[model samples]
Target chain A: MIHINEQQVSLSGEHSIAELAEKFKPDSDIFIVNGYPADRLTTVSDGDRCVFIKKGETPAPEEFQAMLTARHTPGIQEKIRKARVAVLGLGGLGSAVAAALAKIGIGKMLLSDYDVVEPSNLNRQQYFTDQIGMLKTRALRENLLRMNPFLTLELIEEELTENSLPSFFHDVDVLVECFDSSQMKAATLRSVLTRMTKVSYIGSSGMAGYASNNSIVTKMLQPGIYMVGDDISEARPGQGLMAPRVGIAAHHQANQVLRLIVGEEERRRDEHTA
Target chain B: MNILLNGQEKECTDGSTVLELLASLKLTPESVVVEHNHEILQPEAYTAAELAENDQVEIIRFVGGG
Candidate 1:
């Protein structure tokens, strides 16, 4: 048995990826075996994972979705697919969070950023130096789309004030606060948790400098409110926001979003069990 | 009045608003998120959100970073 684009199939004899692609998908030119680009001689054994895609062709949206969903937990595909996630501020945490969620095949995303990519942002943000001066909303969307063409995105490029925040995300299910400013971060969280009654809020703090990653943990401050960070470190002279720590916080927010979305599925299943 | 603040048994001035509680703890207004009885208070709502005995108040203070 071998996995092709996350679907399992039985093979009669040993076959290299090139042989398998030639046999199964003659038109497909890009072959990925176990997450790496399969060399001309890479062989598929039992339980090996392979993905074959055409160089310039986009698969049907449903096929793309199936390829993504086949690897998740049995019941998570539907729940996570329906979740609407909004990422505020495309900085270190926000950019990384958006990328992580998109990489995991999140169905819909509302990304808001009022700034443009800058050379300084290259230190920890998801943007590249080539993207410098491009609007963050536009650059991030382009990057995310390259990875998953089926992702639905709503990009807002304006600065989000408290008055403008609530109106932008009426139907959002999970709002992740990735603002670099403390005031803006708290403002977004407070606005969403108070005005947007139905949205779950996940906010981050203290992803600056080299600290024990162990201190960074997610806390459920209330039923629907969450905070992920060490909660103490502020950016200073020597201790600046680095990629490693910011990436951790970003993924923490992303994982918490997945947990919150998947937890809803668990809750519904539990309700039926009683 | 006595209330459960961050899961700890804490005492505050009688009839203290959420803002006053935060002030008592020396927390700046812009740095923390305040939730009263499971409902998060908006920035302006804090000063008017008076706490009662046995009320649950959760305040999460955050620092600047990405």
Candidate 2:
């Protein structure tokens, strides 16, 4: 069995991609096998996904939306498309998280950060070197828009205090804490997990230094609070925040947000009680 | 006395206040977030919230980094 353009097909014997294209899409000008552009002669086996596209035929917005949903499990993409995720602190972690959700077609993003793109931040942040000194909110919006033109971003350029945090995030379904300061990170978590009980709070603690990537993880602390990191490796003198470790932790948060958007939180609780 | 702290069972002296526990753990009040019996306590409340037997508390250490 194989999936072609998200439709399942049963094969009776071994076949090359060209053969499948002839049978399924005779006018196919290009082939995408396993999510990568492929040569026609490439042999397709069981469970492989192949998409045939004609050259210069860019999918329309609705067709583009269909293709994105085709890659994900059924019933999940719509939830992702409708989700309103808030990212606090458009630094390395927050920028990457928002970028990932944008790529996956998240409907709306509420992003806040007061810092500017500094030359120092280029080491880990997604901002371009040319964007140095620009507000993080502006830089992130420009980048995310380039990825998904359909994305709706609500950008706020201010340092969020405990009192100000909830006001901007009350309507969000998930709030990601990406503050680089320990004090503000704690303050934001306190604000959400206590007052914003309905919102899932995804927070990162300690992705610092050149630690083992395997050490970082996403764990649900309780029902609503999920943490992603080693929770101990604080940035200090010798150990600095680098791209690899920060990206790993940030991806964990992004993956968790997608799961929560698809109702994995509720599914987990049901399985736990069962 | 027995208490549940951060999902782990531990023993602390009965009546140990939250501030005392943070001090014993070498975690400054400014560096951590504390939840006592599932209620997030304000920094000022830490001094008054005392630990009791079987009480549930969680302390998450926060550090500077993305």
lDDT of 2 by residue, A42-152 (tens): 998887877877776654566456668767754888888899999999888999999999999998999999889999898999999889999999988999888887788
**How big is the positional error of residue B66 in model 1, measured in Å on the Cα after superposition?**
1.5
Q: Show the lowest summed lDDT stretch of 10 residues, model 2 chain A.
A: A265-274
Query: Candidate 1: where are CA atoms >4 Å away?
Result: A1-24, A29-51, A54-63, A73-75, A264-274, B1-3, B11-18, B36-39, B45-56
TM-score of each: 0.79, 0.81
User: Model 2's CAPRI class?
Assistant: medium
CAPRI tier for the interface of model 1: medium
Tell me how each candidate scores on DockQ against the true complex. 0.58, 0.52
Predictions in order: lDDT:
0.83, 0.85
Q: Candidate 1: count the clashes.
A: 0
